[model samples]
Target chain A: MELGLVHYLILVAILFCIGILGLIISRNIVKILISIEILLNAVNINFAAFANFGDLDEAKGQVFAIFIMAIAAAEIALGLAILIACYNNRHSIDIEDYTSLKS
Target chain B: MEVLQFLFFGMFALVIVISALGAIFCRNIIHSIVSLVITFLSVSGIFILLNADFLAISQIIIYAVGITILLVFSLMFTTTKDDNKLWLAFAPRTILAFVVAGTLFILLMFNITNKFTDFNINPKSFITKAPKESTIELLKKQGTTPIIGKQLLTKYVLPFEILSILLLGVIIGAAVIAKKDTNEKNRASESA
Candidate 1:
C-alpha cells in the first residue's frame, strides 16, 4: 500500500494512547516521566509528518517539532531533579509512598 | 525504491511500538530505560522517513543520549530492590487508564479515518501554493537544516530566545532543587 498522511496519523495515535496508558498505570516515578516523553514524541511525529505532506515550503511544522524537543529536554531535566529531591526526602521511588498529601 | 521505504517504515514502526510497550511494562527499571532508548531511536528513524533529518538527529542526541542518561542516573540514585515488583499499579486507576486510553485511541482513529477524508485524499489542497519541484528536489538532497536554521533566526527568533532563557532557568532550578542541604549538614556537624 502507498503511504499517505493517514498512515503517519494512525501511528501517532497509537503511540499517544500507549503513552497515556503508561502515564496512568505505572507506579514508578521514572516510568511516568518516560511516558510523558513518549507522549511528546508522538506530537513531534505528527508535526514532522504535516511538515512533509502539507507545508513543505516554510516547514513550520518541523520548526515547531524542534521547539518541542527542546522543551521536552528542559522538562526531563527538572523532572529528574525533582525526582531526586523527593527520593532523598522519602527514600523511595514508589508513587504510592509519596502520598503524604492524601489526608 | 518505494518498496524499500515502506519496508523500513514497517520495521521502524514495529520497533517503536514494541519497545514503547517494553519501556513501560519491564519489571526492571534499568531495563525500562533501555527500552526507552530503543523507542527514541526508532522514533528518530520515523522522523528520517518523514524527511526531517535535523529533527531526527536532535532526537537521537537529546533523547537517546541526553534524556536516557539523566533517567539512568536518577534511577541509580532512587531505585531500591523492591522497585522490581512495583512496576505496574494494581489499584483502581489501572482500570481507569485502560478505559481512557482505549476510548481516546478509538476516538482518534474514528476522526482520522472518517472525519478527515480530505486530508488524505489531497494534502496539496490544504496549502495555497504548491512548493516548486526544484525546491522539493533540493530539500531531498540537502536536507531541511538550512530551511530550519533560516526560519529559526528569522520568523521564530522570539521563541528561540525564550527557549534559551527557559533552559537557563531549568539549569539553575534543577541545581537548586537537587543540591544537598548545606545548612542542615553544617548544623549536624556542629552538634556532633
Candidate 2:
C-alpha cells in the first residue's frame, strides 16, 4: 500500500485518542503527564507531515513543532516540580489524593 | 523504492502505536517511561520519513533523551516501593474515559477520511498539497536545519524569544517549588 497523508493523519488520530484515554483514566500523576506528552507528540507528527507534504518551502509547520517542543519541555519541568511538591506534602503519587481544591 | 518507503512507514507507525499503549498501560512507572522512550524514538523515525531531518534529530535529543531523563528523575523523587501498583484507576469514570476517547476518534476519522471512504480509495485527495520539486530538492540536499533556523529567527522570532523567557521561568519555578522550605525545617527543630 502506498503511504499517503491520510495514513499519517490516521496514525496521529489513534495516538491522540490513546493520549486522551490515558489522561482521563490514569490515577498516577506521572502517567497523566506522560499522556500530555503523548498528545503533544501526536501534534508534532501532524505538523511535520504537513510541512513535508503541504508546504515544504517554508516549513512553517516544522517551526511550530519546534516551538511546541520547547513548550513541552517547560511544561514537564514545571509539572514534575509540582508533582514533587505535592508528593512531599502528602507522601503519595495518586491524583485522587490531591483533591483539596475540589470544595 | 516506493514499497521500501511504505514498509518503513508501517514499521514506524506500528512501533509508535504499540509503545504508546505500553507507556500508558504498563504497571510499573519505570516500564511506562521506558515505553515512552520507545514511542518517542519511533516518532523521530516518522519525522525522518517525512523528511524533517532536523526535527528528527531534535526529537531524539529533546524527547527521547531529555524528557525521558526528567520523567525518570521525577519518578524517583516522588515514588515509594508501593507506587508500582498505582497504575490505572478502576473507577466508573474509566468507562467514561473510554467512551469519550472512542467518540473523539470516530469523529476525527470520519472527518479526515471523508466518512471513511477516502482513506483507502482516494487518499491522495486529502489535505496534503503537492510539494514543490525544487524545494524538495533543496531540502534533500541541504537538510532542514538551516531552514528551521532561518524561520525561527525571521518569521518566528518573537515566539522564539518568548520561548526562551518561558524556559527561564520554568527553571526558576521548578527549583523554587521543589526546594525544601528552610522555615518549616527551623520551626520543627525549635519545637522538637
Candidate 3:
C-alpha cells in the first residue's frame, strides 16, 4: 500500500483518543492541561496535513494551524494563572478537590 | 525517493507516538514534561515531512519553546509537593473514559480505512483541488512563507487583527488574575 492522507488521519485519531484518555484519567490539573494540549496538537497535525496534500490556491490550513497555535498559547497562559489562583486557595492542584464546580 | 519518504515517515511516526505515550504515562511529572518536549520536537519533524517548512518552524518556536517554557514555569510555580503518581485509576470515570476512547478509536479506524479504499484510486483528488499539473510541482514554484504572509494580510486580515487583541487581553487578564491582591488575601485569611 502507498502512503496517503489516511495514514496521517489515522495517526491524528490515535493521538486525539489518547488525549481524551489522558483528560479523563488524570487527577492533576496540570496533566489535564497537558492532555488538552495533546488534543490541540492532534488537530494541528490534521490541519497541516490537509494543507500539505491538498492543492489549494493558498495554504489556508496552515494559516488555520498558525491561528490555533496562537490561541493555544493564550489559553495556556490564562489557564495556568487560574491554576495558580486555585493552588493558592486550596493548596492542591487536583481536579478532585474542586467538587463544587463539578455540578 | 519513495523509499526515502517512507523511511523518514516511519521514523518520525515512531518517535512521535512513543514519546507522546511516555508523556502521558510517565511516573514523574518532570519526566512527563521532558517526554512532552520530545513529542513536540518529533511533531515538528512530521510537519517538516509534510513540506510545511514555515509551519514546522512555527511549531518549533511556538510549541517547543514558548508553550513548553510556560508549562514548565507553571508546573514549578503551582505545585511543590513531589507526588509522582498522577493517574486516577480508581476514579469511577476512568473505566468509562477507556470504553469511550476505545470505541472512538475503533470507529475512526474503520471509517478511515473505508475512506482510504474509496480514495485509493486518486488520493490527490479526494479532498479538493484537481491540480491540473501536480501538487509538489506547484508547491515548488512559490515559497510557503510568502504565500502565507500574503494570505494573512489579504484574505485573513480580520482574524489576524483579532488575534492581536485577544492576545493582549489574555496577557493582562492572566496577570491580574494571578496577582495576590491585598484585600482578597486578607479576606481569605480572615475566612480561613
Which candidate wins on TM-score?
2
The per-prediction CA RMSD against the true structure, in angstroms, equals 2.2, 1.4, 2.7
Give the DockQ (2 decimals) of all models: 0.70, 0.79, 0.64
TM-score of each: 0.94, 0.96, 0.90
**Winner by DockQ between candidate 3 and candidate 2:** 2
Give one digit per residue, the lDDT tens place, for model 3 in B1-192. Answer: 767876887888888888878877887788888888888888888888777888888888998899889889888888765556555756578898899889989888767667445545224434644334555576678657887899899999999999999999999999998887789879989999
Candidate chain B TM-scores, in order:
0.89, 0.93, 0.84
Error of 3 at B136 (Å): 4.2
**Prediction-by-prediction clash tally:** 0, 0, 0
The candidate, 1 or 2, that scores higher on lDDT is: 2
TM-score for candidate 2, residues paired by index? 0.96
Q: Considering the two chains of model 1, state its CAPRI-style docking category.
A: medium
Identify the runs in model 2 with alpha carbons over 4 angstroms from their true place: B120-127
List residue ranges in candidate 1 displaced over 4 A.
B115-131, B189-192
For model 3, the interface Cα RMSD in angstroms equals: 2.0
Ranking by DockQ: 2, 1, 3
The TM-score of candidate 1 is 0.94
The candidate 1 chain A region of ten consecutive residues with least summed lDDT is A1-10
Candidate with the larger DockQ of 1 and 2: 2
